[model samples]
Target: MTWRASVLTIFPEMFPGPLGMSLAGKALAEDKWALEIIDIRDFALDKHRSVDDTPAGGGAGMVMRADIAAAAIDATKARTPAGTPLLYLSPRGTPLTQGRVREIAQGPGAILLCGRFEGIDERVLEARDIEDISIGDYVLSGGELGAMVLIDAAIRLLPGVAGNEGSLAEESFAEGLLEYPHYTRPREWEELAIPDVLLSGDHKKIAEWRRAEAEKLTRKRRPDLWAKYRKS
Candidate 1:
């Protein structure tokens, strides 16, 4: 089955924005995956199409109305295949990881709910079984950018999306290490020569050097990943 992604947001035009270019766009055009944008405001009950209201306990900004968001989610689910995961992009959610991206890439697809204002109502999130995920510690004006980031991450991992499958193996977080540095022609630039091992054509030595470098960089830059790598 094609990997399908449905995004529920107040701004439908925001989707396929950056996703419409690069590898994700190519994959999209090839039908490797499908994208559907659902406008949450379309589900609003009021004639003005209002989807948010004041927070129950009082807040500086409006909270997305639970009933309206739920309606949009329900409508999307009804048309989408069963078992598709539902996700909400939020600041308080679990940090997104490559492992999670891989899981979603291996699944049928996901329904992403892009929240605005303060956030969506907690009640509907529980009722719909939506999994909240955050791209990082920082916050954005809305969840559309987060949804795009997530979709792009997953799409590139799908079959035939990336041109070099081997490159994926050594990518940072792929093997719990930062990628080894690379050098190209112009062997000597600014009096700096390409690493001798790379030009020596000793495959075994090159591999060993790369591993050492990757480990060294990881240990210095991301001790957290280095610790996990050492344990594994």
Candidate 2:
């Protein structure tokens, strides 16, 4: 089945924005995956088409009304393949990871809810059994960017999306470590020579050097990942 991504957001135009370029764009053109955008405001009950309201018990920003949010989610769920996970992009959600992206890439698809204002009402999230996911610790104005990030990650992992499938195994987080540094022609630039081992043409030695460099960089830059790598 073609991997699919359904997004419910107040800004439908925001979708396929950056996703319409590069490898993701190529995969989309080839029908390797599909994208469906749903405008949440379209489900608003009010004649004015307002989807949000003042937060219950009073708060700083408006909360998307539960009724409208639920309606939008229900519509997406009904059309999407059964058991497709429903996700809401939020600050407090679990941090997204490469493993999660791989899981989604192998699945039929996902339904992503892009929250705005303070956020969609908690009741709607609970009622729909949606999982909240975060790309980082910091917050964005809305979930549209987060949804894009997620789709980009998943798209790149889909079959035929990447031109060099073998290279995927060596990417950062592919083996719980940062990717090793890369070098290219023009052996000398700015008085800096390409690493000697890379030019040695000794495949075994080259692999060893790359592994060591990957370990060193991961340990220095991300102790948390390094710790996990060491433990595993």
Candidate 3:
């Protein structure tokens, strides 16, 4: 079955933006996966088509109405395959991880809700049991970008989407450690030469070198990941 991604957002045009390029785009064109863009505004009942309003408790920004969000979600859920996850991108959500990305990629696909302004109504999220995912600690102007980030991450993992599946296993965060540095082409440049071990043409030694480098970089750059790696 084709991996599918359904995005519900007020800004429908933002979709397939970056996802419409490179490997993800190629996979989409080849029918390896599918993208569904649903405009949340279409569910608005008002003549002006307003999807958001002032917060009940009075917040700085408007909040997406629970009724409208629920309407959109319900309609989309009816079309999405059973067992597909419903996700809401937000800053307060659980940090997105490689393991989670892998799980989503392995599944049929996902329904992503892109919130705007202050965010979608909390009641709708609670009632629908939507999973909240955060790409990072920082906040963005909207969840559209986060949705794109997640879709891109999952799309690359689909079979045949990435030409070299083996390379996926070696990528950063694939093995709970940052990927090892890479080098190619010129054997020497600006006084820097390819590592002797890499030039040695010994597969075993090269593998060992890569593992050590990955470990070293993870330890220095992301102690949090290194700590987990050690525990595992």
lDDT for 13 in candidate 1 is: 86
lDDT of 1 by residue, 33-143 (tens): 999999998999989999999999776999998889999999999988888899999999999999999999999999999999999999999999899999999999999
Could you estimate the TM-score for every candidate?
A: 0.97, 0.99, 0.98
RMSD of each: 1.0, 0.7, 0.7
Cα deviation at 169, candidate 1, in Å, is 1.1
Candidate 2 global Cα RMSD: 0.7
Clashing pairs in 3: none
Residue 20, candidate 2: Cα error in Å is 0.6
TM-score-based ranking: 2, 3, 1
**Candidate 3 to truth, TM:** 0.98
Candidate 3 Cα errors over 4 Å, as ranges: none
What's model 3's lDDT at 91?
94
Best lDDT among the predictions, by candidate number: 3
Q: Choose 1 or 2, whichever is better by TM-score.
A: 2
Predict model 3's lDDT versus the native: 0.95
Write candidate 2's Cα lDDT for 1-232 as tens digits: 9999999999998879999989998889899999999999899888999999998798698999999999888888888899899999999999999999999988998899999999888998888888999999998999999999999999899888899999899999999999999999899999999999999999999999999999999999999999999999
Candidate 3 lDDT at 139 equals 89
Candidate lDDT scores, in order, read 0.93, 0.93, 0.95
